[model samples]
Target chain A: MSTAAATHDDHHDHHHAPTGLKRWLFSTNHKDIGTLYLWFSFAMFLAGGFMAMVIRAELLEPGMQFVDPEFFNQMTTVHGLIMVFGAVMPATVGLANWMIPLMIGAPDMALPRMNNWSFWILPFAFAILIGSVIMSAFGDGNPSAPNFGWTFYAPLSTKYGPDSTDLFILSVHMMGISSIMGAINVVVTVFNMRAPGMTLMKMPLFVWTWLITAFLLIAVIPVLAGAVTMMLTDRHFGTSFFDAAGGGDPVLFQHVFWFFGHPEVYIMILPSFGIVSAIIPAFARKPLFGYASMVYATASIALLSFVVWAHHMFTVGMPLAGTLFFMYMTMLISVPTGVKVFNWVATMWRGSMSFELPMKWAIAFVVLFTCGGLSGLMLAITPVDFQYHDTYFVVAHFHYVLVTGAIFSIFAAAYYWLPKWSGVMPNKTLGELHFWNSLISANLLFFPMHFVGLAGMPRRYADYALQFADYNFWISIGGFWFGLSQLLFLAVAVLCAMKKGEKAAAKPWDGAEGLEWEVPSPAPFHTYDTPPVVK
Target chain B: MSEKQLSVEERNKRTLKKLLIWAVAMFGFAFLMVPFYNVICDITGLNGKTSSTAATDVPEQVVADRTVTVEFITQKGDGISGEFTSETKRVKVHPGEITLVHFYASNPTSTDMITQSIPSVTPGEAARYLHKTQCFCFDQQTLAAGERKDMPMIFYLDPEIPRHINQFTLSYTIFDVTERVAGKNNSVAVN
Candidate 1:
């Protein structure tokens, strides 16, 4: 591979090198599209985070202080919709686009044009969502967006939802279409485009986890599409799918939504498993213990997701037999999940572990995510769920898994891979400071919620009795601090992106392995144009 | 040529084979969803017709000398003004078969009140095989302050309903709807 040959292999056979706005609008370059996804998701994160702050501010005391109840509902609903669809999912997709090809030694994603379409659809979908919120601000029919919790259960959604609900439905439909397309592209890239010698077992764990996550996304996203479509028809078409007045059951909506929702929870976390698997090894200076078992465990979790959906609906009038069945099925997920956690700890056991910023987040993720998992297991018991069903405990449980588990892993990945992407090592001191503040405050924010929940405080309550006031006060204080701590991450990320940091080597992490390391720092515009021989 | 080049082609073929396996797997998955969906619907009773709607689907009929008494009882813990003291007003019957009852309830409080639970009634207790179907009791209701709304309870005295008859009562209890609060000053109202 001479220099000229390498440049030709990289640059030749390339599509038009569009510049400026057109490059983003009409281009299909994987790296450009990836950057677009990263930036877009970051923007959505800020917007969703703002909504969270509003929610925390409202909950600070109990009674409403700033916004009306209807407006508050919109904030909560839109916040969830945006964070899950706009921020987290796109962030994961961005990482996959940037790293998967390099990791597996492929030139680019297999379906490049489809990739552009997937990214492009997101802006329009979010536009519709934001547009609906703006529309609700006007006093047209109901001056409120969807007040139904993000779950959008029936009867309430069908009978009492605002006119803006129609727009929310359209926005969701668009988002679902975008996600399915993205998932398809990922599946094709991982399955069809790996370089020679990169067998399934030989591929990096990140790629393997992504492959499984893609399948889960593809399988369950359509079910969500179906659920939302039913909601649309029930709202507008007078269809009785969720209306008891016309031969429908409200609880039926929960059955359908959670069927998709439970798998969705895994879709968010499975990739975090991949991120941790990658990071723990590098920091610990060892090969990931039980790599094959980790892959199998992820697959099992994905498969188990479909059966355990009813766990979310245990208190919704299910028979004793059904309740017990769901309880046991839900608990069984821990076996595979526990296998993954054990393997990670074993990989770290006795290894020369260094607490780099990325490693700090990874180590924290394992401990905090296990806390969430244990709580989840506690909720899985039928008799216990009757008490915990709609409490802040459930809220605490999920946020622990999502924010601490999924979001922390994302931060770890950003620190781990920023050097590779930016050609500069991030300021380590600032990175560590961000990690410590986030880790401590995030626990301060969510840890007390478990006790509040156990103390008989129901979730989704605007006001509480005096008994819950103490924990609520602390939780709100923690939330505001957690919210502010994110600014440090944003500052560090911006500084690194602007190249105001130390120059980095191609392989900065000594134990880091994968074809991704074969490229130079700040991986070239076209990586592995002539795909590497994987061996 | 290196042995590796030949093996690359062999591996591509293997990849294609695996892809075929996945495609077949996806196909089997698509095939399974319909039956699985139906199974879930059956298990959850999501597909079952609401009692009211089921009543309407029955063939319209007229009958003679079928006498049935319909009683509406408020659930034990309910404190709504209409629950115990409110007048039953008028019970209009079509005589031979079907009858429709329009019930009105008022909430004296400024805040909204929700009907949390409805008591189930045995058919025989209501009208002795006179089909007692299609009632507002099937679903919970939320009433606003000083709100007087008419809820329809439609039923037919299944000529057979009276034959199996003994007694039946519809009862409801009112509670407060929960509200969701986010951080300070941001609260979403939920029912």
Candidate 2:
């Protein structure tokens, strides 16, 4: 509309990208880097999912079926680490990288070279992390991989942790560096590179949520780095930062970790809020209800995340007031979260609604994520959490929020944008099949965890009491079914990229809005050489 | 204030610098949390870390009618090659009364050792009201190889301790600081 032909010629000097490996190795293109991130995330997802399979296989009959308990501990530990750091977090960052520039009418991410660096750091970090586990499993003398859980509680991590703990610590430091750089890039890009007339409020929800997420990343990642640094010192340097006899306390570690950790969970979900906000409206044929409130709610949730970290430590002997304060603050999160859920439903209320693949995913996200949020609220009650802490119920709550909430929204975004990215529509039948299978299996996989947890099935154990046998049998079945169903999604995505379906129009969905839709399908390698006027 | 007048590249650099600073500040804040946690826990009487020094303002009169159960527990911390136990597993004392407890510590290894006892009072809200006029934990103890010592700790629980907290445990975790203290003194000697 604004002389795209003219800008095309203007960027001709920068048009020819390097060939093959060099293109990826030295890519400064946001789209290229974003693809790298998504693929990396998928690979990590498979790796982490493989670990889940191992865990399930062992728990199938609760008699130590497939692997020994030590190997089992390694699987659980690395599974959580890979899924959280390696799968969910990067997938969201991938979406942010791909969509933010396109939505904001910017030429590219603000610091493109830095984007490349961020994407590249991840594979090496993960290599170090996984390598440690492999060495522990195979190597002699039981140089065990980090088995102290992903939280890496002290005393266990400091005194009893295996030699591989150092490697785990180093890997975490690298991941922290990568995340901080990525966050900085997002912040700078959104802050400075929007089209001339695109004011803060007028920008897409994806960009807004990402902007806040970047701030959270910038603020909290360093704290995590510090936490690990102290652990490192405690392990090797004779420092007693978490050693009580030497004037430091292990409880100090939890305080520092959950401080970074609570906000980190929000970092995974806030963008899901953005992705769902965009998709629900497009399918509902209605403007998002309470957009301003959505913005306020996201900010309030971020603010509240900082204060409510200690709910994770209710059993750690906090002062009664401290416990109550954390509980109240944690419950307060439900209000803004409810606002978000209500707004999504309200937007769909009385509107001409379509249940496309993306919409189906978004709809499931709303309902299932609310269930996760409700369980989270139950866990927030100090007294209730005393019963549920470290149990399968806690595991159930997170997997629902993370898998259904974050990953489902990711699926919604992928389906919503694949046409634009690949220039062809995906096979709707296959897409729907993938969606339904995933939804049902995911529920089968996670829903019963709440019941099992309430029945006192402690998590992270290779074997459970015989009473949990039936539920676990079903849960394992659900896990395998859910794991296998993702292959269908992979097939759909690959076929779409191969241009198998109908050629997508510039705007694929009739109700979709934003500068992203205004661009031609299969968005050119470079765009917005000259920033388009927003108005 | 004048950023809008700058070129986009320049403005981007400025924001980058600011964000980087914020990141550095947050990193520092993480380490700062260690001290902040201690201060807050000390002030609010949480995390079970009782006072490290003598209390001069303890009340003169003891409330003989109400006897509170003060449980004594001794633990040997990591790397501590020693046996630590309390002579009295539990004691009943009136609020505001001076109470003495004996703890037995022995060095088992074939070398001189220095150890420090760190005390924590659980039902942590009562920590502030439990005052120590003197404690072996106040200074590191030196024990020759196989030497056993009976150390005395004198303390008082203020009548102001919350009525609901009729019982609390005071735990001492003894850490072997022979290497740590020797390291410091060696460094000092070299300096």
Candidate 3:
């Protein structure tokens, strides 16, 4: 895009947005790639959600009816892998793609070609991952897809693993490469391309959170790449990285995997911290109560993440000193996390607040995420973890944070920004219906798992004891209803994109602030052809 | 464009190049962790790979006031056919006193085999304190078909074995490395 072309096309739709499939296939625009990332993630969510339904259905009556034990394992494993890599992380990146340049007043991302490459690579990565699952189910040879849980712990992943593990390893490498590229784009755009006067501290919270999340992605994704690579060699080559018979230790695998795994959990959620930080303040009509503290808190959480990974392995018989060190360090994370939670409520305290669809999701996030955090704190205590480990309680704790916390924040962001992208208001009734339907049913689904988990209903089991049948049945019903509620979200998005509602003005929310609000609704094909001064 | 604008372009280009290079370097760093883990194990002895050498000083052995129970455990690798058993299951010894243990191994299969026994000390911190003067683990054992042998471990637990534990398990898993050795030099290139 040249200066002359940019000038000609900045406000003229006729001169840009190349028609048909070429618009997506050959596009260099950040907005287009962002849109692609969002739709792709939504599709992955539906696919993964279907797998969750199969799992819940099989568990409903304590005897496996819908799927056999093997397929059940596949369902849980692929569902987690797809949701984390394909759904949650990509959606966050999608939002960053659309909003960061606008929030920072940059003309576009620093490297547009690489942005397109990152977005396009996701389809092939997911294809191989999902396709391997299909191949595993039907292939004449040993199954290929990863069934060793999303954690893919060794022995199951290595020495005794199936033929398809090699493909899983390759898919993970592709995903890692895509993530690292996406992170590089975000970091470079934030640092080098911010418009004049948009100081690091002055940029919007979403931008700040993405900035830190990008750093985290760069740091951990490569470590994961290393981990899977070792797994690959151990399985295919004679190298005994995780083979005990070969003088290699299996627990060594856990130490390396969780090193990446811990930061990875944060990589999923920290952006939600940024998202709620943006939505709560806007709806509250107040400057964030502790913006500085929130930034530092996020940084502290990121730094502490590297040290607390061993908390996940308490049941693996870690040395006592290692156990105590990780336990206390993991608890220390609560302090910074508490700061973030308090700042959100403080921003809303006594303020003239209005609840929009986005605000509703954000509010739900604050309460639900705190509940998740408390359970996480419980898990961090070394002695108690022996009981909770691999139980439904652990499952409930993560889904509460991951589903209700991270995914809900993504829902809020989509609602908040859908009008800007499509130049029309999301149908309010459908939005609210989606929120309440999801909220009530998701609680019903996840909350009972805690009780049964404490009662010793081990997670990853295809069947439960007869004593646990009632809770499992209720939980399954909740899962189906929660899965159905998402169709409302899909409808709201498609209709808004089709321009079914009232046309939006440049600014939709009355209390909104930031460079994003300064742009026209249905942000033009090109914006900030020359950077807008942030001041 | 002015000189300042040119410099901004130069700076952005340099930083972008640096980041791309860093991404490649990070990928390399992932492969590095394989060797890196072994380095840490060498330094900290975290994996509990006990060294079977006696201390030069040979200080007078004084039995501690408390005892740390040592349990002998054994397992045969799936790919190997052998009857591996420990002569004794458990021994109670005061810390700082020497103890001797024996293990029996017989090649029940028709083929000759080279067997390597990998040892681990549980309550892992105990690994550092359990010292060996002579143990079969120092060398791999080669047994012909129908051959049997007795192996010995001479060792003492250091007084430093922490107070919280009264018992620890030392287990050895045996792997038949005949084919693996012929396949390659098969020794774990660990430090």
Binned by DockQ into CAPRI classes (incorrect, acceptable, medium, high), candidate 2 is medium
Q: How would you encode candidate 2's per-residue C-alpha lDDT over A1-535 as one tens digit per residue?
A: 1343355466567778789999999999988888888888988988999999999999889687878888888889899999999999999899989999999998888888889999899999999999987787677427778888888899888877888889999999999999999999999988888888999999888889999999999999999999999888877776788887678889999999999999999999999999999999999999999999999999999999999999998999998888889999999999999999999999999989998889999999999999999999999999889999999999999999999999999989999999998899988888988999999999999999999999999998999999999999999999999898888888888898689998999999999989998889999988887777788
| Real interface contacts reproduced by model 3, as a fraction | 0.34
Using TM-score, give the best candidate's number: 2
lDDT of 1 by residue, A423-510 (tens): 9998888888889889999999999999999988987656677787778888988888988888888888898889889999999999
- State TM-scores per candidate: 0.79, 0.96, 0.95
Error of 2 at A17 (Å): 1.2
lDDT of 2 by residue, B29-84 (tens): 99899889889988987788898778888677888889899999988877766779
Give model 3's TM-score versus the native structure: 0.95
The best candidate by lDDT is 2
> Residue-wise lDDT of candidate 1 within B22-82, one digit each (tens)?
5445435533444464456444433321132234346356655544455655443325554
In order of listing, the candidates' clash counts read 37, 0, 1
DockQ of the candidate models in sequence: 0.06, 0.51, 0.44
The interface RMSD value for candidate 3 stands at 3.4
List runs of model 2 lying over 4 Å from the truth. Answer: A1-15, B79-82, B184-191
Q: Place model 1 in a CAPRI quality band.
A: incorrect
Candidate 3 DockQ vs. native: 0.44
Consecutive 10-residue window with the lowest summed lDDT within model 1 chain A: A1-10
